[model samples]
Target chain A: MKAMQGYCGFLGLLVSALLVGFLAVLFTLVWVVHYREGLGWDGGSQEFNWHPVLTVTGFVFIQGLAIIVYRLPWTWKCSKLLMKFIHAGLNTIALILAIISLVAVFDFHNTKNIPNMYSLHSWIGLIAVIFYTSQLLLGFLTFLLPCTPPALRAFIMPIHVYSGLLIFGTVIAAVLTGVTEKLIFTLKNPAYSTLPPEGIFVNTLGILILVFGAVVFWIVTRPQWKRPTEPNAKLLQPNGSTPEGTDYSITGDFGNVDKSDEDGEAAARKRNLKLDEVGQRSTM
Target chain B: MKAMQGYCGFLGLLVSALLVGFLAVLFTLVWVVHYREGLGWDGGSQEFNWHPVLTVTGFVFIQGLAIIVYRLPWTWKCSKLLMKFIHAGLNTIALILAIISLVAVFDFHNTKNIPNMYSLHSWIGLIAVIFYTSQLLLGFLTFLLPCTPPALRAFIMPIHVYSGLLIFGTVIAAVLTGVTEKLIFTLKNPAYSTLPPEGIFVNTLGILILVFGAVVFWIVTRPQWKRPTEPNAKLLQPNGSTPEGTDYSITGDFGNVDKSDEDGEAAARKRNLKLDEVGQRSTM
Candidate 1:
């Protein structure tokens, strides 16, 4: 009964995240296409439109899903290794779209002979992209590669999770600033201060983006929602003790055992053994 | 040795957070006083300057310090009740300043006949303030009051922490958008896109705010940095089983026994007993 309730709560939140995320993308499209010029690569303001569209779609929405992939209860039955691949693949796609969006802005600016990277939005957006790239590379090297040491992977896991969420928040900040800058520049006649339809629509879009981020962060941080350790995996402590609530299996080293299909008492026994090891080491 | 290393890390991050936070406030002051018309209430744009100044100092910096107050290593020996009061007091101050900031913007708009709550920045900023107020009230009723049930406190703890961080991120988003809007409107002579001195200074200020946020989030989330369970507090299980690594003593119910200054074997035995209870409950 408890499991069923948890599933319902997770499903409700997941649906809300998707609905809000979809609305964010839809609003951006309507604002850019119907309200402004449709997207293009002709080195015009139309090219710059791709910046917002791609950012909301890829950087904000897709990256958010990647962060919470492990918390999806349905995915719990899958091998941790397979889940890591899915996580990495999603992040890589988000990065590619982000790069293209960055290119769109620069191209439009250079063609119009306008200076770039002067505004706070541009500075923050550039920094977020740089950090995203570093996080992806480090995550891939530490978790994806089988050659990495378990101790090293354990050491990097918390730092990796911390930076991932930080970058997500930074992306949301950049998006909000970019939207404000674009509206202030384009809405001169109506004046964003006067609250035109386009202004109201995009403001709703920003709220949706913020809401999506909040939902994703909640899912990722919930202790109850963490992925369970693999049934037969050996739990290794990096600093002679495992911190509470951390699942070392996240590092993708399941040791030499392959009792993946084990169930009932055997699985319970393995888990107990892991706890006893933690207890003994912590006391020492 | 490990304890010393942990303390050093905590100190370094705390110092970095303070430095960046100070720089953010200083830049905001310089941008407003030296570059703009300075602070005033003459129904001019100058009246709006108080919005950024107060939001950066109170909403962003002080609220951030309040969030991490429990993580201070030196304060681990302090009574958790005293710490709760400190945390609540800091948040209350932040809320008061935030309310004043809101009033400044609204008064400026009303006096100047400008439409209010029109842009994305206003929408998100208002929502963040509303959430902060609700969070503060809920935290006080549950944590500071002696009448609240222990089980209820345990249930609300995670949600409280989650919403606190979420609101902080929302505030940063609002600040960044507000900065962008102000720059676009005010930098008309050379234009914001021209990379003027004032623009660059404020841009750096935005970066400092982001870094400060990143550092605070890091300190709060590190599992190693959590306040230890009280030396003599009884471990209570909220849901028949305790989730891994969670210290239930955070609910502020130390039970009828007061062993606040107990040391040596008795402390170790109490800690071990808590672990054993957790182990036993999990296997059930």
Candidate 2:
């Protein structure tokens, strides 16, 4: 019964994440097409509309999904190596869309003779993209490449998870700021303060994005939901036992050193040893 | 040598957090007073200036300090109960400031004949404040009140930490959006997009807030930095050993259950047993 409840809870949250994510994208589309000019690339205001659309769809929603991909129970049956590719592929798609969105805004700005990268939104959004790109490259090298040392992968894993989530959060901040900037600039006729339909719609979209993010964070942080080490993994010795003194308990916020990639076996073993040392020491 | 390095790293991040937090508040003041109107309560825009200043100081800065208070190595020697009070006190102060800031904005809007709670900034900001208030009160009841059961406290502990960080992140989103809104509205003479000095100043302030937040998250999430289970805590039996099958290996993302509060002894024991059961299971 308890297991059933846990399963139900996970399903409910997953559904909520998807529903809110879809609504957020739909709301952005309506806000742009129905309220503002439709999306375009003619060096016009419409070209800039693609920024919010792609940002919500790719940067916020898709990146959020990438963060929690490992937590999905059904995916547990798949080999960790396969899951890593899916994770990386999703993130790559999000990055591509983000780059295109950046081009849209910059292109529109240049054509319209407006200064670029001046607003808090642009500053933050650009930095988040740069950080995301760096994180992606480093993560791929550390977790996916065969030549990287297991010790190094173990060392970088926590930093990788922390930075990934941090970048996701920074993206949310940028999106919120970008939405505010857009509304302020575009809501001249009815004025944003009048509580116009577009204002309420876009505001709802912003809240949905936040809710989606909260759901993703909650899913990924639940220790019970963390991906388990595969039975065939080499973390277990030939005798089918974990190494002596291995501390399985020191799961960080993202949990268990992500035993779902190519280096996961050696990485998990090395990380467990490191965490054991850290856990034993009371000071540092 | 390693311990010294860890300590220095902690200190460096701590100093960075403080520096950025102070600068964020200062920039808000300068942006409001030097660029726009100074603080006031005459039911005017000047009264509204208090909104940004107080939100950054109380909501973002002090509240951030409260979130990472337990991670400070110096504080590990202090009683957990005392730290709880400090945490609650700081959050209470932030709540009070947030209330006053909310009133200022509402009053200014009424006086100016502008509708309230219309923009994405207001929507997200108001929800964040509400969530913060609820989280503060619930945290107090669950973690502070002596009548609460240890089992219950353990169950709620993770949720509390997760929500606290989530609310902190939400406040940041609100602050970023608020800054964008203010710059767009106030930088009309020079135009925000034209890269006015005020615009650049406030944009930098927004980035500072993000950096401060990133630093705080890093400090608290580090497994090496989490407060240790106290020596005399009841989780360690009278014989100075954990109970059989206790599974001390299952430390969660925040580290060992907090061992400083009044309920630390019983709560830690109960929490460990629960985690042991969950950890042994291959699936939730």
Candidate 3:
């Protein structure tokens, strides 16, 4: 188990770094290589460029990073509430970017007199975005809110986790479909069949996106990779002890109460193992 | 939890049925609608039609079914070895079909003097096949072979599970890319942008494929959906006691000995719970 942990620790960081780098390259490929005319909300075909650029940045990259936040070892010492806020914040940014990207696509289509939502990619992409928005809102209400009862939190937690991962997968699928659509639609000189540099880069980007999704999902879902609660974890501040301007938590909801429960369980299990070891030693 | 199980069971069945129906529809779309010229190994464009037809049949549908075989409720009553054989058999068939599909693609490209592995779809699809083949061989060595030590099996099992899911997702992404490529490539008169009936049907098929992939992943990964082990499960036949022509097991490796250890743990826990209940009743 120790060896496995060591392996995952190194591997997870390498993959995460690669994922981020790939996102940057993907952004550059679309924005810098293809749309050198520069981005604007009202420009001609240049406006359409934001659809891929922001979607990759906010939806694919940010959303993926958000999913793996819990598995990040560096963040293990951070407050769970703070981590939750960070997760929600990143997703919120992704959502805002996605919405704007959708606007860009719609605006471009309207300007060009092209049909809207004509492709399978559009249909699934729209669904993914809607699902993501709802997921975020529900997650915020259930997890971040203090008024949420423990029973409700427990009941909804599993579904939230499952839905989050599913939506991430859905988003990646949407991006692949979108990229394919764009490449096939735009490339005509050498044809996509000839495998031009742009086509190759786009294809590599798609593959990297898929790779990033797989790595993120693997890291998030592996049971042994989940962050362990610290035994001496500190309690959150009491009621009316909100962190300065932040109004999210009014009470010590993220306190040591939950941690102590888990810590007690762990301590009991450890004591039982020690007793077993002593018994074995005596017999020997 | 019982309600959750009920929900998952019904949902799994519904999704599985829909997946099969979608695959049939996808086949009908390509073979019946687009390629009414009929399928032949030596025909020109007709041979190209087999690329999509066989891929959807073997790579997508059969592979998916193989992934979820353990989750099927009806299969719980079957012998573990028999289920393993069924799982391996379906995958073997899927692998054969995938190889044949690859041959068809290469053959068509060769006959037309078209370049091979040019598109992003082909690259990802080929990689998926390679990964799937390797995963199958490794799984066979670790699980089916009696020579594999228990420690090795324990170490490899989690990785096998993770890789299986990753490959399934990769294949789905490849399929989406392929469908997008074909729709863009084949439709000329109306063009894919016009969304003709064939284009519409093809897009819907792609969407259905995505839905099927999502459903299969959900069913396969959910802990509650896993088939429960029977408490009184029978042991595999001992050496020279193999059933009929089967010779894989030289010992009762699939026997109930391991299960008894788990059952004993459960019984001890139950006894502790009962003692606490009795003490509480007396105090009350």
Per-residue accuracy of model 3 over B59-178 as CA lDDT, tens digit each: 888888887786555455577778888888889998999999899889989999888887778888989999999989987887788787654664566567667777887887888778
Residues B1-284, candidate 2: write the lDDT tens digits. 45555656777898998998999889889988998879888999899999999999999999999987866666655777898899999999999999999999999989988888888888889999999999999888977887887556655666777788889999999998888887777788888878977877888888899999999988877655555556565445543332221112112343221112213323443443344344446244
Interface RMS deviation of candidate 3: 14.7
Label model 1 with its docking quality class: acceptable
**Candidates ranked, most accurate by TM-score first:** 1, 2, 3
Tens-digit per-residue lDDT, A105-181, candidate 3: 99999999888887878878998999999999998998889787644664566467657877888888888888888
Interface RMSD to the true structure, each candidate? 11.4, 8.2, 14.7
Residue A131 CA error for candidate 2 (Å)? Answer: 0.7
In model 2, what is the error at residue B141, expressed in angstroms? Answer: 1.2
How many clashes does each candidate structure show, in the order listed?
Answer: 0, 4, 1
- Model 1, range A109-225, lDDT digits (tens) per residue? 999999988989999999999999999999888887878876577567767777888899999999999998888889988888888888888888888899999988776664445
The per-model lDDT (C-alpha) reads 0.76, 0.75, 0.66
